[model samples]
Target: MKKLIINADDFGYSRGVNYGIIDSHQQGVLTSTTFMTNMPGAEHAVELANQNPDLGVGVHLVLTCDRPLLDTHKTIVDANGDFRKLGFYKGAFTIDYEEVYDEWKAQIEKFLSFGLEPTHLDSHHHINSFGDIPEVFLKLAKEYNLPVRNNMDITEDIKTTDSFSYLIETALKDDQSLNELFESNQTVEVMSHPAYLDKKLMDTSSFTYPRIDEVEFLTHPRIIELIDARSDIQLSTFKDI
Candidate 1:
């Protein structure tokens, strides 16, 4: 059987986003989600997770687009205490791995403090996949006995999810083509952002994203029809495997 891990990212972004993610799991195909510990809506996300334990929770570890959980001063962020734009930072690659490791540990500990045992680890803007940063996550994963998202391409032994764009495209594609295309693959993991964007979300993100549309697409009756028509594919959570 083909397994699919349908996960919604950014669980603790805003009220609209948090509620939308919960709605996706409750009324649609979302099986898992990753939380941002330092975001504004984290406590609310924790409450939602408590109400729904079956929705596998993971740490959406932040490395950009926000301040760190722990301090790195100028090493990771500017004097103004904000991270540089993703493109500028990606181009520089001047990061202190040890500082990064310490910050990630703090984030994970915050999750644990909330009594959540994360099923996996992934990063904001996928900074963990950038050069040399995978080592930090791998080390922490081993230390914590958690699975790191296969952003580093270690493969076969690591946990992972497919890109958000690819998953959205496939979901919005003609159903006739998707079923035939999936006939060959035994498993697929779809990463997604199924949310109702709030002004807070707009303020945090650099560009306006189509979150409401994505949620609509994920919960649409056509998606249900496509999934039911393919007996070979089973919707699964990360912990289910």
Candidate 2:
């Protein structure tokens, strides 16, 4: 059987994002999502998750995007104390692995404090896959006994999807069919960012307006019909794996 996990990233990014993810899951084929525990709408996201127990929820580990939960540190934060922007990671930058582990551990702990059992682990901007960070990421995964989104560079004995794809952008840009995307993989994780645009999203992320389009694409009737018709294709969540 071909099992597909359509996971929405940044579930707790904002009220707009939280609503968009829920809409996609309830009305569309989205099976799972990861929460940004440090985001402003985290509590709201938790409430929604509590209301919809079937939607698989996990922690979206962070090192970039928002302020850290721990006290300000030299390596991960800028002079203003917020996490350095994405560009900082792209260039020559220094990150302390110990700090990353501590912050991420706290993020997961915060998520657990809400009484929600997390289904898995992933990172914001794929930061956990960068440099020596996978060491820390895998350490936490083993400690927590949680599955992770596959990062090909990491060779540790960690639980993860067989393959991973950013389906929201690739599907729209290449017009690829679902079967082509899934190929021979029995278990695939397709990443998506589906959200309604709001002032917080607009100010915080440059990739804002396209999320509204993703919500539409994810919930499209044709996509739902295609999955339903394919007996070989089963929609699944991380927890199911």
Candidate 3:
């Protein structure tokens, strides 16, 4: 069987995001979520996870656009200790990776302290796309004995989106270690931001409502509900296989 972990990204960016994630998990197809430790409602998201017991929670490492956990004057997006913007799609920025590594380690430590031994790690903005950062992510994952989302979907459906397909293809080419992880049979987290068209989300971001709707109806919800809610459905965390 092809096992899948339907994940939701940006768990703590806003109250609306948090609400949407939890509601999607409870009422829709979301089986896992990645949390932004420094985002707006992180604590509440954790609390909800504790209550639900079935939601898989992982750290969504924020390195671009969003503020850093560590205060550094000369880093990429850190301008006087706050994030330069709220999105990273603009362009890749350069940073001193050596200094950033120390801060990244601390953030992981903080997440673990909250009783979430993350099963995997993924960057906030796919910042892993940058040079050497993917190496940092691999090192961190190995150190923690966790998985970094390998993003190896080669099936025909994934090819429909050229950008997404290209991302997966590049990951497959660059990530040799993921070969074993692929064979190990543990689920890799795959996420999408699908939502109803509403004033709340529309006013906040330029995310196309039409695309969101396409994902909502396209993702296999019935299968997800059956699998996630199965009494055989053992609760899974980032650390659980």
lDDT of 2 by residue, 1-241 (tens): 8788999999999999999999999999889999999999999999999999999999999888989998857799988889878788886777787888889999999999999999999999998877778889889989999999986464557778878887665642332466676676688889999999999999989899889988998898877886788787788999877
TM-score of each: 0.89, 0.95, 0.69
Query: Stretches of candidate 1 above 4 Å error?
Result: 155-157, 160-165, 171-184, 207-209
Give Cα distance to truth, residue 160, candidate 1, Å: 4.2
Candidate with better TM-score, 2 vs 3: 2
Question: Measured by C-alpha RMSD in angstroms, how accurate is candidate 1?
Answer: 2.3
Q: Residue 36 of candidate 2: its Cα lDDT? A: 95
Across residues 119-220, which tens digit of lDDT does each residue of candidate 3 receive? 567777676545666667666766776655554322331111112211212222222423332455434444555444445445645664643552443244
C-alpha RMSD (angstroms) for model 3 = 8.3
> Model 2 shows how many backbone clashes?
0
Give lDDT tens digits, candidate 1, residues 1-241. Answer: 7667777888897788898899888877778899999888899999999999889899998878677777655677778887656785567578777888888899999999999889988788888878788778778877776765544665455545442223555643666655554556545557788788788888878634677777777787877677767776788766755
Q: Give the poorly placed runs of model 3, Cα more than 4 Å off.
A: 84-93, 152-189, 194-204, 208-241
What are the Cα lDDT values of the candidates? 0.76, 0.87, 0.57
